[model samples]
Target: MSLQLPDVVETYFAISNGGDLSQLASCFCSDATVFDENKTHEGLAAIEAWQHEVRQAFDFEVEPLQALQEQGQLTVLTHLAGNFPGSPIRLNQVFRLEDDRIRSLEITPC
Candidate 1:
């Protein structure tokens, strides 16, 4: 979709797709929060744990299909496929960035 995403956001997708836990955690601010699966994970420790659990539970890949930005927030539409139910689904990832790091992210089904 030719999305010119911010560096941090691009790094997020890259690390996530590669299943690199350390690199994924590095893309976020220390106090970053991630909202997914109807739960909130706060701080780098929590975010890392959440990412680890999810990655271990499902082998998934996210492909960015579209993107939109407003103020300091960027929302990307992504196609996710994995071994879980609904092997392929569209999702919207809303991210808020600060100082080149992801401050917060909320992912929801599209």
Candidate 2:
């Protein structure tokens, strides 16, 4: 399937797959937030730490299967596959953007 995502959102997924920690900072604003796995990560430093923790825990790749935008929020249906338990799973990634950067992101089960 083909889908078009906002520039920042596209870059987020690209960076996620690339696993380049340095480039990950480019996907979000300085004070960005991420809500995932019942934990909240605030600020760029926290987010980077969260990403690093997850990378060490699960070596996975995310693919955006579909995207929906409304009311300033973009929710993308993403598929993850890797060596983690279940092997593959789908998640709903809700992103709020600001000035071409991701202001916040929340990942929920889909």
Candidate 3:
């Protein structure tokens, strides 16, 4: 399927909800990078490994609240929820897409 910036975010939530690492990996470039919380991960291999590990821990949903785009990037506001108290977490996802795959993602809690 052809991927777009919004598709990147939606696919993330979908794969995450299904706990599918392979599907998640497909959304990224081979050298895609992700910055979450305070940690930075380089490459789809690392992102896939990280997702595999973290998916076992958190069961949050990437509930899209708002979305904005400029140039070739998209910034999405979402709610993350799971096992923790006050589980519903608000966050922002900044996505940069290259050839329809996510080239970079920066996530920050709101």
The lDDT for every candidate, in the order shown, is 0.89, 0.89, 0.79
Clashing pairs in 3: none
C-alpha TM-score for every candidate: 0.93, 0.93, 0.86
Better of 1 and 3 by TM-score: 1
Candidate 3 residue lDDT tens string, 16-53: 67646678667999999999869999987789877887
Better of 1 and 3 by lDDT: 1
Model 2 scores a C-alpha lDDT of 0.89
Q: How far off is residue 29 in model 1, in Å?
A: 0.9
The residue-by-residue lDDT of candidate 2 on 19-95, one tens digit each, is: 57787678899999999989999999999898888888877899999998999899999999998888699999999
Kindly give the stretch of ten consecutive residues in candidate 1 with the minimal lDDT sum: 17-26
Each candidate's root-mean-square deviation in Å? 1.2, 1.1, 3.6
**In terms of TM-score, which candidate is stronger, 2 or 3?**
2
